[model samples]
Target: MFFNHWYKLVGMEALNLLESFIQSAETGSFSAAARRLGLTPAAVSKNVARLERHLGLRLFHRSTRRLTLTTGGEQFFTQVSDPYSALRDAFAGAAQDAGKPAGVLKVSMALAFGREYLVPLLGEFLALYPGIVPDWHFENRPTDLIRDGFDAAIGGGIELTEGVVARELAHTHVVAVASPAYMKGRPLPRHPSDLAAFDGIVRRSGATGRLRAWTLRNQVGEQAAAGHRARLIFDDPEAMAHAAMHGLGIALLPMPHAAPRLESGALMRLLPGWYADNGPISLYYPSRTLLPPRTRVFVEFVVDAFRTKGLARRFDGR
Candidate 1:
């Protein structure tokens, strides 16, 4: 009875600071955690210190150059993050039973995919599960689920990382698309080599803005040459699609993102014979022993939604 009552009266500040401390530990920088929360470095430091004092244990060994979690800090953070996350999920489930999903479900999603595909689906999901609220972080940059506290993310080319669990929610194909105006009687590329002549929209490297190699695969599964370069470049896929739509150049984009334009004949698939890794899009979360019922329900909802929609279809079939 005392335990039940105590859980109910737990203050938000303690939990918020705990979450902040976890982020600071993961990123190894108070300033980074501050930036994420829109707080100053001093504020983040103070909050963590407060939480540490409350627990009567030093959570981090701070220095001017680096912040490392102390042995106790490491154990405390690791042990607490799961229950804290679960507590939040449980509260949300209770709210849902009364007719709403009431917690912040942090999610990271690709810019283009989020905008063109996921955005449309949210309204329907909210209508069905009004208690759940999503705090969506849209970016072209790759997300680190552990460091970032995201409940789930939808991304292409996901490499299975340690301490993370992923479901292959869907698979999709990449298409080389260009605007009709961009084509303007220009000779079409017959092969990947001919792509050299055309301007290309590209994904930027994580460390630097340098263009990344686009890998293409053929029907026989022979990997195409790995180093196709781009002339024009963009970091965000949506920007690349927009640029391609405005007659800037060719783009290898996810089929769903390019669907409306292609269907309207505003953009056309170039070199249909060639194929590339449409990388399996996945829903990833922290590999935990106990996933809360709310998260389980939402994950199932999302996976079912994608599967039901036939999300992996390629352009050739259309």
Candidate 2:
């Protein structure tokens, strides 16, 4: 009975050695597999040798030229590697969940969107998932997602780019708004060109100012006419919104930002018959098959939030 117990212990040690040997073979280097298993190269090599001795088969044909797995080793690796990999993934996932979801999640977003919409939303997201800590960057210029090491990004005018997956979180339309005070006696713009006659306030990169060339579509003409250069320019939509409220001029801004004022009748829409292009506000991330859990969770959250907020309504009729 003591010998039987001894044999069982031996068998378990042999199994451990076998697992180590398989990992070394699959990696094709003792040092590489050692790094993966958190063991020394000598230890991995020793276990692989013991495994080969027990099995009575050559596992690797070691040469100065290369570390080549023998035919038997290759067959074993092909059959077992997939299951072993799956097991490792499962274990890692379990470990991550055992504690808090621990990892740095980098995000890139538009300055205005980040400040106005996401700043508050992010606080809620963090409160809900205490394990996640977000490192967010906001910029006005176009960004390279991969070069910046961002786990994900949110922005307007999402271009089709390779190596990334993009999903539209919401639809946003550009509308011209002028203060009720400005429009009191002046005729509302019946056409796109009519905007040029009024002073226009613009927003870009958090600064409010005047802009040049406002693109407007003329339904009757069946074409778009680019408005003349702006005499006044500024950054920050809220500033522009406020300016329009104070009767500064006509401002083109996103629907959500302008919606409240429109509803309140503080601002009136220009060129109501000819609509501006309502594009997507999108969330994008790398297109790797195995997405990190945090990225997946955030994307799902944003999708659900937009749907719940009726984000699609702005572009429905357009």
The whole-model lDDT of each prediction reads 0.73, 0.69
What is candidate 1's lDDT per residue for 210-298, written digit by digit as tens? 77666676676655643355666676666778899889888887676777788889899887656665557788876766554456656
- TM-score winner: 1
Candidate 1 RMSD to the correct structure: 4.9
Instruction: Give the poorly placed runs of model 1, Cα more than 4 Å off.
Output: 1-59, 69-100, 184-231, 314-318
lDDT of 2 by residue, 1-318 (tens): 222222433644745675677666755778766755557888988988876666666879987555798888787667666655565445435535435454556788877667766776777777666777788888766766654446788887656578788998877667777887888788877766777788878654422333434455545646566354354466666667888888878888777677767878888877775656657788999886556667777788778877876655743323
Report the Cα lDDT for candidate 2.
0.69
TM-score of each predicted structure versus truth:
0.74, 0.61
Best by lDDT: 1
Colliding pairs, model 1 = 100-131, 101-131, 101-132
